[model samples]
Target chain A: MNAHHLRRGALFLWTALLLAFIFAPIVSTIIFSFNADRFPSLPWAGFSVRWYEAVFADATILRGLINSLIVAGATAIVASFLGFAAAYVDYRYRFLGKVVYTALIALPPAVPVVILGIAMLTFEGRLGLSGTLTGVAVGHIVLAVPFAMALVRMRLADLDPDIERAAWNLGATPWAAVSGVVIPFCLPAILASIFLTAAVSFDEFMIAWFVSGVNETLPVRVLAMLQGQVSPKINAIGAIVFVVSMSLVVIAQVLIGNRADRSSKRT
Target chain B: MAFWAIPPILWQFAFFVVPLGFLVAMTFWSVRSFRLTPDMTLANWMFILKAGFFRSAYIYTFKLALLTALIASLSAFPAAYTLAFRLQPRTRRFLIFMLVVPFFTSYPVRIYSTQIFFSPEGIINAMIAPLGLGPVSVLDTPTGTVVGYLVLTLPLVLLLQTFALMNTPRDLIEAAHNLGCGRFRTILTVIVPTARVGLVLAATFAFVLSFGDYVAPLYLGGSNPPTLSILIADQVKSGNNWPRASVVAVTMILTLIVVMTAMLALAYGGRKKGRG
Candidate 1:
């Protein structure tokens, strides 16, 4: 091959290597969860369903799983709804203090999560809100809301304002216009935000570690257990988390699929 | 319009801004007689700066973030470039989707697994053992932490730069080609210049994420030299030195601001040259 072809081949190789690097750990975590051996290592033992069964059998793991789901579900609903409202306002009405609005939305991602975690702990002490699902959910909403708003904002920008205007001109009430116009238009992105935020809340550990109190989320439990010893059981839990989040992404993708067409119709 | 903004603004102020303000204030106040006091002083900040361990932790954290960003951006560029320019559109979307799947999973879990694999008798060592490259453990090493951060931030940075490259108008690239530029020459001149600011933003983001991450360092960083995040957590959890922890947190945040400002300036400078 000439230099150009050779360069092309190297590029393909690099991409393949990156793909392997990205997928390997998760793939191994899932594949080895079914390992018959107690330890996660080479010399493939016979595949067994025992590990998946073990995850369900353990009470702490099961409870942690439930707690995680609760936090994630609550975060998705609360964050997405509030975020949609915020994003809609930002998109629709550009005001003089919009710079301040932009700065506030950008805060969570800019600050290190550890600071947020510890800050909330002390701050909650003052409010007497420390160590509860409500507190933890609020913390997650703080982290996730910006992202949710960003998503809905993108979708809203794509949607034709004329459609909403047309509805208003035809004698629709405010609620009626939202239900008949904005809801259908923003449905996919709103759903995407819900799943997306759910994924973030589900995987979140650092902030949740502080605010969670006695009830540990799944990631916290895994971290706590791993601090003591390495168990294939932890791997099993990790596998399940990987699978669940992957499914959530697929669901989000399905929701977001027709968005290009939505935008394409705008121009 | 004001009403539309009220709910989120109120929520952020009630939860986010107030807490952050408290954290900032906490940094100036020092403990007295083992009780939380309102005696505002820079003594906590002075103590943190003077301490050898805290200083080293800061250095290690910044170094590791830089290293991870370097690794991530270097690796991400090739993949992102290929995806943007080489692959068929259908294949490109599928690959991008595949790339994104890892990030949706639990990040800490992935780091923990990286730790597991880097252990002495870990799977990686076991595989390499027969090849006489036996027992390669990087667990707790600065290198190991970088590896963990690399995996965590790589996907994010890759997605970012891939979009950056995608957003670079194709006609500009064609124009460069028509001007007698070879493919590599075209990439160096046309593609990179257009994507410079975005690529810089992506790298800086990767750097920030890596530096702020306590999880990877907790597991992958060896017992002695912990990163800033790990050190801050230890101070808060074990030392109960909330004031000192706040100082450290403030320092890290400031350092992050400096790093970001520098990167943004660099990206902007490059953009000026591109425009010229």
Candidate 2:
């Protein structure tokens, strides 16, 4: 082959291998979830719905899932409300300590979650709120707020100020202008942020590990299970979680992408 | 607007900022058999400095963090390059989407899956069984820990790199190619130089994520003494050494700040150069 043809062939081969490496473990887990064998490894003992049936039968995994859903739902609601407010002020007012506020919001994700967990442990101890679901929710709020804020802030930056100005000029109050006009305009961004926040809170481990007392979230339960022993059932659990999380993220991406495209077209 | 801002500000202050300040303060307080005292002391910081075990833990953790960042970024580059430039636009989007799917899954679940793949009776051993490569012990080894890091951070690096690469002007690449440059030569000369900022940012993200990670090592790094994160946890939970934990916490925060600042400066410099 000529050099150009040879180069193209090499690129194709490399891309295929890269894709395989990325997807192998994922595909393997999915395959094992269907395997009838007790071991997670190969030589599939024929396909069966036994593991999925077993997962549903297990009270612990089901409870963990429900706990995660509640925490993630609560976190999304509280974080998005607070984040929207914070982003609005920062975007419009240019208040004192804006830089500091921005930095603090960004800091949690950057700091080690373990350290944050310990910090929360100490802080909650003083408040006598340690080892409570409230404490875990508080921790989730702290972590999820920054992500929510960043997402909303990006949307706010894209919005035209004239729309709000026009509402004000028409004798609308500031709250009326914002609530009636601005929020509706940024609805897609807000929705995306909620989904993203929920995913993050649901998946969070370290912070939940420290703060969760008698209440175990799905990830915390999974960690406990893995540490105690290797169970093929964990693979079944992992496969279900992977599919659910991936679907949520895909939905979030599609929403955000669609909004961007529409906005660009409008402009 | 002011009314709305008030509640979030108050909530954040109470829950976020105040907690961090309290943690710093708690470090100095005395702990006697798990009960904290109001009396302050410098003994905890001193203990961290003098204790050989903690000192070694800090060194080992730092080394692992550095190696994980370096290795993840290197492996990520090739895949990123392929997605960014080599693939058709439709195919590129599909690949990028596929890469990010892994990240949406729970972090602990991902680590648990990695354990299954690398454990003695796992798939890797199953694949090698016929070759007499009996039961390779991948989990619990430093190498295994690094593999876990790679599995966790690879998607992140890829996503960041793809974002960076998307911003590079197509015309610039075309210009270089028109000048008789080979594809690889064009990538090195035109693409790499332009995309270096993204690479650095991706590396920073990888470093910060891997360094701060406690979960992967906790599950996979069996028998390895606590990483710096685990050490910090130990002090707080088991040892009741809050002050020393504070010192370690402060050290880690400072290290991250330095690295993040350097990455930002590099990105800023690149943007300024591009504009010029």
How many steric clashes between backbone atoms does each model show?
2, 1
Candidate 1 per-residue lDDT, tens place, B212-275, comes to 9887777787634788888888988889899999888888889998998999898887555568
Model 2 chain A: which ten-residue window has the lowest total lDDT? A14-23
TM-score of the first chain in candidate 1 relative to the native first chain: 0.93
Clashing pairs in 1: B140-B221, B140-B222
Q: Which candidate comes out best when scored by TM-score?
A: 1
How much lDDT does candidate 1 score? 0.85
Tens-digit lDDT track for model 2 on B1-276? 568677677777788788888777766777787667876787777777788987887777778877988987777766777788777899888877788787677677667777888877778888889999777786787777777777778888878887787878999989988889987788777787788888888888888887778877777887386677877777766777776787788778778889889888876666766756
lDDT of 1 by residue, A1-267 (tens): 498898899999999988787778888888888998887777889998798898899999899999999999999998998888888787677788888986796588688889899999889977877788778888999999998998898888877888887888999986788778887889999999999999989988888888888888898888788788777887789889988887887888888877876566856
List runs of model 2 lying over 4 Å from the truth: A1-7, B129-135, B223-225, B269-276
Question: How accurate locally is residue B206 in candidate 1, as Cα lDDT from 0 to 100?
Answer: 92
Clashes of 1: 2
Estimate the overall C-alpha local distance difference test score of candidate 2.
0.79
For lDDT, the strongest prediction is 1
Stretches of candidate 1 off by over 4 Å are A261-267
